[model samples]
Target: MNDWRSHFGFHTTPFTRELAVAQRFPLPMFDEVLTALSRAVDQRGSAALVAPAGTGKTALLRALVDQLPEARYRVHYVKVTDLSKRDLCREIAVACGAQPAGSFPMLVRRLQEHFLSTLADDGVRPVLVLDDSHGLRPEVLGIFQILTNFEMDSRLVLSVLFVGQPPLRDLLRQPAHEAVTRRLVHLATLRLLSRPESHRYLAHRCTIAGATTIPFDPGAQEAVYEIACGNLRATDQLAAKALEVAHDAGAAIVDSAHLATSRRLLWP
Candidate 1:
């Protein structure tokens, strides 16, 4: 049998590979978002999920995408940050496999028409997952309101799910954005993982990376949880570094020394 230890170097975790980590350390709070998304997609309604930075919002979205039944709906995930309204529309249009012919307004119209046609042909609702929506300009955010108009009497043809940080909630609260905000039937905010949850998260990542058992000592685990401040992103960063330190030292298990070294290296 191949030695699992040899998997080192090739086994590092990445921030973008959220589906793998989410499977190992499932966050229960995201279940509400998943349930809401599934129901909204079925009913063709709209929903929004918001949380603080480093609270695993991206990871939760990735997990939802991974869990979503491919046969039931067409999913288009887009991250809108620092992009102009025209650029955003073009990107969304391209994701849906349609090219816009003219200006920004024309592109929006084309995207809506394309989405409606797609839903009719595929017999499935079109789901648009917009991430970092808080970064969108007021005009661009208005595009979502326009899309929501493409709906039937009982079901919507296009369903939009907005995911972002707390500023997204603040943006929705603005009176100017009331139209889009009012259509959001479901709202959820992801919370930081509790202490035990953090511990489990670290151990889970280690195991997924091929470690048969947790390499961190009890004290080291506590230190990680404390310094990570309940954020999964921070925990993963610290834990991964600790593992690297242990691997380099040929230590079978990570101890207080490894934890201290990793902490100093990461935070200081």
Candidate 2:
């Protein structure tokens, strides 16, 4: 077979990792998450997104970025690390387009100046989105307070969005982290879809890929749900692989057999 997408009459690769914002499925949970996080950033408030792996944390982060207007908000995505406080400042400085060189205190001043300048000069609120933040050390996570100290915390010049897995929630709940935790205005979460939502999600993905009709039969859909348990990334991987398996076997539509083959090929 040439390619599964072609065999299935798809104009583009379905269940792909890269998708335009407009092409994203209208999952109610995703919409709710975006709305809550967007509201937090718009109000110059901080937030945390805690979800398990493959629940679409990165996708939702990208969507939230698109949701915020560039003219109003300058979003900086910082890759989290277990670095020292000064090194972490360097990382954040680099993300904020500030010169990433200085002692810890100097770097903090410089970053504060940069943020104040952006707000004063361009009328833009700078947002720091830290992904994989569950990996950040307690000392490093404490840096949020230093980052947000604007005019004795009276001025709201920056917003920090913490994106991580469930452990992040527990990490933030520590008594030592109470100051930073208090700053978070919202905590958004993404969940595995229900069975019916999984079916609709697959259909919506097919539509987004320019398919005239969904190719997964009922049996195949159920199999994917049972195996993937409605995690968005898992569903995408299983369904895409199942389509390939079906195409290789010259099947007209994906069925439970194809899904079973996909399970073996993917898991075993």
Candidate 3:
């Protein structure tokens, strides 16, 4: 069967969630968040990144990891769920290259010492980036405060970053978690793209995929922004589906009709 790539003369599928760091869309809002998070990491401080679903939170975390140089930073990226505190610490210990086979208390001490030695002996930064942290329980979140406390909290040996959806903010706001919240040096929230930015984003994706000209009609572009509400992931899904629908129908450009059909076919 003929695919959209052949129909559109694309080098690869456009509007995919797969982000090639070299070719990522240069969004100014993302840059601003990156700057704040980067500064927090540099200072060996913790920060919170909160955004709604489909707003490119995972992509932003990957970009942040890529931008931090390996020579100076030892970064461990962990995607957390509702695991128990012991299980979570074991995962963290494994990520830090420490033995995860000890008792729960031993595991915690091992990770704390690992972070300390990583900075004091190796002279490199240890950054713990936790993604999807909204599911972490209140008590589990408190473990970070204890782990980050080294040398009587007089010195910082590690940097921690929490990336999750909006519920994470509410989670942190709870009275019990206020201690964890106070440790955050920055709180960055990602917003949806503006209408003009969304238009440019579509063009940018098309250009990166080797399209000499945009295949999405102006009306289709407007439909995408409207239906997807400028969420990056939603835009990708809708745009890719529209392309397939247009190609199947032998349409030269994806129009409002194609977008409407694609949305119905995808959602309903």
Model 2 Cα RMSD, 1 decimal: 1.4
- 33 Cα displacement, candidate 2 (Å): 1.9
Residue lDDT tens for model 1, 146-195: 87775543446788998888888888888988998888888888888889
Instruction: Flag regions of model 3 displaced more than 4 Å.
Output: none
TM-score against truth, every candidate: 0.88, 0.96, 0.97
CA displacement after TM-score superposition, residue 70 of candidate 1 (Å):
2.3
lDDT of 3 by residue, 1-268 (tens): 2578868878888987777987888988889999999999998899999999888788888888899988889999888988888999999988889988777788889999999888888788999999999989877988998989988899988899999999899999999988889999999999998998899989999999888989999999999999988889889999999999999999989999999999998896
Q: Count clashing residue pairs per candidate.
A: 0, 0, 0
> What are the root-mean-square deviations of the candidates from the true structure over C-alphas?
3.1, 1.4, 1.2
Error of 2 at 67 (Å): 1.6
Error of 1 at 237 (Å): 0.8
Local distance difference test, each candidate: 0.77, 0.91, 0.90
Q: Regarding TM-score, does 1 or 2 come out ahead?
A: 2
